[model samples]
Target: MRCGLVLVALLTLPVAAGRADEADDAFAKKLGAIVRDPRQSLWARVEAANMIGKIGPNAGAAAGDLIAVIERLRPTEQEPLQEAIVEALGQLGAPAKAALPAFTRLAGRTIDLDLALKQSRDAILNSSDSQEIDALARQLLSRDPSSRVRATKALSDLGPVARNAAPFLAIALGDADADVRRGAINAINRVTPNAKPTEAFVRAIAVDLRDPDANYRLLAVRALGRLGAPASIAVADIDALRSDPDPDVRRAVVDALNRIPIPQLPPGVTATNP
Candidate 1:
């Protein structure tokens, strides 16, 4: 039995190592072809770019080539090609940090801010460095209103690393635009995983919960869940909702209660709301 186990391990190691090397080599070759083949279809180049992004930081050397391709294409030239570049840059992570200045410049140009925001968010999420994320978050915060909205959404996507934007996000929670407020609330929830709702915010959310828009109420419920048990406003409201005339509200209330941490409840507090 021992001998068989040893034999199996020995046989598997070299084969696994060989497969890894083969994959790496194949990726390198495909990357080279994508950069060098002018006659390649735009879709093929885009596909190769997507593959490089999936390959991660090891594809750093391909950054220059990818940037060259991006520069050659007009803003409206090829959407697939542009998306591929964004994904590849994201995959490159810290190695692609050098491209940020260029990206910043391009973002300031006549190009679509929405698309630029998407790319920037991708880069921020893929970045290995916290400093890089901080810098990008700051830039996004200060950009145009539309970009700020996108940045807030991206920061939410980055989760706790975006804690720096909490103050700004809180301010956004009161924005005149409902969309902006929603985005801010989302960012706040992301940064404060164990967040406790302030009485005011809780009250405001409760009012939103009764808004004519079902989606707004749904988001408010989700935010309440993220706030944990101290979100008494949500707990009380949801408990009442358990017997609500509307089936949807009752279901939402049940789901919300399931998310609260029972152990975190104050002393004497039962798992069941009174």
Candidate 2:
């Protein structure tokens, strides 16, 4: 009786696994249809992408469908969908490799897709932690805005241990995209705020003081304040913003100035504050 029970259990295992695979494939197929349907609402398509990612590699059948959806969209209509698709592709890991070329082409169409693309490729290759960090650092410097945004965010999530990416992040401070610049500052604050601020970094933050966006100016001042003494080079620049048109910016400027230890500069040397 014991031998018979063991035989039965062994026989059921493959059948059960097969059923599970079939079910996963069915679900993936349904979700892929939703993703491919133009009539679907943006949120619906995004939710479908999320579901495919949640299913992981078993939903590999949907990889080609997801790529098709991305390739079909015009740039004007892609912003909301592409990010979600890129994220989903990353989650699919090895099965999504065929989509790599699509990711590359999409990256050229926008600045936000590169980081996600790199992440997807990493997933396909199953990169190690160190490799991921190295890849992200390289992506941080990518001219693709989306790539830089994703890279900064990934580094920020890694916390202070990712301080090595800080130098690359400094370059992002002057990025054309405000979100990328903001992400860089936020990452810097997390990764190396306690370390001595770099001269180039201070100059970059100082430039933000004159940004047309009031909120970005506020964020820049707040980051400088957090750096305290290291950010003294930007003291004069912060002081100039004391009379900014925006009241909130004026208040943050005051707080930042108080935190930053102002230094006296020599007459012959001009402060590179801005």
Candidate 3:
């Protein structure tokens, strides 16, 4: 009787798992049908997209079809659709890498979409596995822009772990996509805030400060400020640029310098208190 019971239990396991998969497939099919059907109200489509965002990176399988839904709508009508798709793609991480162009096209074109797009772009590259995140960071040099962006955004999301991604980010700093380059520089600064000014980690932002693009200069200055006193070593660099050609860049220089503290001496090298 024990053997009979064990056999029945084992047999039922596969059926249970299969039923779960079947239910998932049925749900996805129903969702796709609803999203693609014109008869579905805008609110219904919105709900479908919201469901995808809730699923996060687990929604990679539906990324393509979801993107298709966005493409079918006019750009003027894409804000709400963009919000849902952005959340879904961000959650899907590396799996939705192929749809980056679609995401990029919408970037910076609309005020509402821009903020979500900035935050959403990083979601496409996130992963629970540190190793997977590391590998994705190494793809910054991929000939495919989308693939490179995937790595860039993933590394950015990894924060301090991006210290391991410095080499790749250095490469990304030279990428043609202005967004990727800035993102890489931003990640390097966030991860290496306390790194000595002379460290190679600061090289990426150093390049950005001198970059002709004011946006790049502004980003570099913002990072320097975020570093506070540990980054005080750049005082000469910042002071020299206080009269920068761009008003925003100059303001950042002042703010960054002002934010640096006076008491951040190197470890084991204490300074006398005033």
* Model 3, span 1-274: residue lDDT tens: 4433432333243223234545555454455555555665665666666665665444455667777876676677746766776666666667667767787777766786777777666665444345475677667767788777777777767677667777677777777776676677666656665655443435455567778888878987887777676566555566666789999998888788778654454565432211
Candidate No. with top TM-score: 2
Q: Against the true structure, what is each candidate's TM-score?
A: 0.40, 0.47, 0.41
Error of 3 at 240 (Å): 50
Off by over 4 Å in 3: 1-26, 128-274
Model 3 has an lDDT value of 0.64
> Which residue pairs collide, candidate 3?
57-91, 57-92, 90-123, 90-124, 93-124
lDDT of 2 by residue, 240-274 (tens): 88779999998888888778776996575433322
- The per-residue C-alpha lDDT of model 1 at residue 16 equals 33
lDDT of each: 0.63, 0.77, 0.64
Best-first order by lDDT? 2, 3, 1
Q: Going through the candidates in order, what is the number of backbone clashes in each?
A: 0, 4, 5
